[model samples]
Target: MNQAGMISTSVSTTTMISGSHLFNISGHSITKELPAGKCIMSSPFVVGGYQWAIMYYPNGLNSYDQPGIAFTLELQSEGSGVEARLEFCLVDSHGRPSDIHKASSFCEFGYVSCNRGFSGFITHEELEESWYLRNDSFVVKCTVGILDSSVVEASGCGTPGNANDTHQAEHLPPSDLHEQLRKLLESGEGADVEFNVDGQIFSAHRCILAARSPVFHAQFFGPIGEKNFHNIEVEDMEAVVFKVLLQYLYTDVLPDLNEFGSIQIKETSASAIMAQHLLAAADRYSIERLKMICEEKLLGTISIDTVATTLALAEQHGCGRLNEACIEFLSRGGNLKEVMDTDGFGHLMLSCPSMFNLILANINDPNVLRDLVIRFSKTSIKS
Candidate 1:
C-alpha cells in the first residue's frame, strides 16, 4: 500500500516587513496575506506517493535587520509511485542572494516516500540532499521518484512483516489447583518427609511437617494422634502444622491425637470424637488441614454437649469468631430448650449471656420465659 501524507508547522515573528518586498522565489508561491501578524506561503510537493502542500513564515531578522523567515512544510503521500523533490532560494532587500547557513540542531526533518515508508532524517541531511537554500529557513520539496528505479529499490517495500509469520499459537488449558493441593498435602509427614518451599528444601521431617501445621508430632502415632499436636512456642506454626498433617496421611496413627486420647481402642473415644468434630468443622470451612491438626489436639475433649458448652465459652472469652462456628453445630434442631433449662443454663448464661440473649430473642414467644425459669430452678435444685 503506497500512501502519501504531509505534516506542516508554522513560525511567527515580531519582525515586520512591507508586503511588496516579501517576494517568494521558489517554484511555489505565497497564496495569501494572513492577519496583521502573519503571512502564508504554500509549496507544491509530493510525499508518500502523493502531492502535498507546504508553507513558511517570518522570524526576527539576521544581523542585516531583514525579515527573518521561518517555515512549515506539509506533505501528503498516497497512491503508488508518488515522489517529489524541490529546492528554495531567498532574495534579500539588496536584490542580492543572502549568505546561507545551516539551521539549528533542534530543527527536524521527516519524509514519507511510497516505497521507503515513513522516516526521519536530520534537517542538515534534508537540505544537503535537496540543495536547499540556507540564507533563510525554507521548506524545499520536489517530486523525487519519477525518474529513478534505484531510489524506489533503495526505499524497499513499506509493508511490514513480509518476511516473517504473524499468526499466534492457540492457548493451552490451565493447570489444576486440586492436583497441586493434593501433591503438596502428601509430600511429607512429621519429622521424616522432605519437601521444597520458596526454593529451599529442608530434609528434616520436623521442619517440612511443621510447614503444614502449628502442631508437630512423630509419624508412627497415626492420623488421630497427629491431630491437636502443636509444638510448644514453635518457631514457625505453619511449618509445624504442615509436617504434622503430612505425617497423618502416611500413618493413620497420629501420635498427637493418640496423646490426647487413651491408648486402648482408637474408636470414637472422647478425644477422638472431639478431634473428628474439629476436623469436620475445619474441613467444612475449607481449612480442613488446619482442622485436622486441631481435631487431633482436641480428640478426647469433644462431645455434643461439650461443643454446645464450648460455644458459650468461646463467646464469653471474646472468641466470637469461633463462637459463630460453634453455634452452627449446636443449632442442629434438638430439644435444646430442655438442655438450656438445666443448671447448665445458669452456667451457660453466666459464661455467655449475649449468646443466651441471641437465642432468647430468636424464640417465637415471650410466655416461654416462665417455663424456662421453672425448669432452670428444678435443674439447679437437683444439681
Candidate 2:
C-alpha cells in the first residue's frame, strides 16, 4: 500500500486499478458561522461510481474531539464489500495546495464504517485566522480510489468491450477533423456557396453544411429545392444570428454568447431574447438538436418578465417543451397577476387565448378571469 500522496488497494488476487472521486465543498464557508449543530453536511455529489457527501461538525463530535470543525467522508454507493482507499483535504485559498490540510495516510472505508480523518484537523482558532474561508465558501477535496477486479481477470489494464470507447474518449484530445473543419469554415477555404442575410455574406462549404443540416441538404441538393450557384439571399433573420446558426452547423457548438457583441440579453433578464431568436432560427432550419438546445436555454430563462413572450415564441416555433414550460411557469400561483400586467401578457393572451383558462384556474383570485372575459367580450363586440 502506498500512502504519502497516493492511495491504492487490491480487493481480489487478479489485478489492481483505481479511479478518483472528487467531492468538492462549494458554498460551505458559512457553515461554520451557523449556530448549534454538531453535524452540518454538504450536498451529496456523485462521482467515481459512488454517491458521497461531506459532514462537518461546528462543535466537536465529543469532549476529546477538537473544538474547531471535524469532517466525515461517507460512501453511499450500493452493493457491499467493495473496497475504497480515501484521502481528504481542506484546499487553501492562498493558491498553494501544500499550505492546506491533507491526510498523509490513505485509509480504507466502505458502507460498514466511515473514515473520520484526524480530529481537530485544524483548531477553530487556527482556521479563523487562516484565508481558507473566503466569500463564505471553501473546498474539501476527497479522492477515492476504487479497486477494479476486472483488471486482473483481463491479464492487464486492457479495456474490454465498450470500455474501449471510454478509454479512447479519455485519452484522445479533440479530433483534428473538428478543428480542420472549423478552420475551413472560418478561412472560407473551398467555400462552394454563400448566403446573404440582408447585406452580410456568409460563405460555407456545401458538403459540410449539407452534412450538418437537413435544411441545408435540401436547399443545396434535394428535389424541389433551388440550386445556389451564387449568393442566396436569406430573409427573416439577422446577420449576426445567422452567423451563429452557421457556426453551430460547422462545429456543433454555440460559441460563448458573452463573446458576441450583438446579443442584447443581459444577466438579469435570464438571457432568453437571443435564445428565442436562435430557437426561431433553429426551427426555421428544421434542426432538431439545435432546436432542443435552444428550447432548454429558453426554458431556464422563463420568468415573470419573459414567460409571456417566451410562450408566444415557443408557439410560433412549435417548441412544445418550451411552450409547456412557459404556460406552467405562469400557472404557478406565486405571481400570475403581476406577470399578466406585462405588455407581453396581452400578446400571449391574444395569441394563446386558451391558456387563459389554465391561468385563471391556477391564480388565487377568480375576479381576474372575469375581468379578462369581460374585456375580451367588449373587444369582440366592437370588432
Q: Identify the candidate with maximal TM-score.
A: 2
Error of 1 at 262 (Å): 3.0
After superposing all C-alphas onto the true structure, candidate 1 shows an RMSD in angstroms of: 32.5
TM-score for candidate 1: 0.26
Q: For model 2, name the residue pairs that clash.
A: 15-152
Model 1 ranges off by over 4 Å: 1-205, 214-273, 276-288, 292-307, 313-334, 341-347, 370-383
- Quote each prediction's TM-score: 0.26, 0.56
Best-fitting candidate, scored by lDDT: 2
Model 2: lDDT of residue 231: 79
For model 2, how does the per-residue alpha-carbon lDDT over 132-156 read when each residue is reduced to its tens digit?
Answer: 5555566666655666555333322
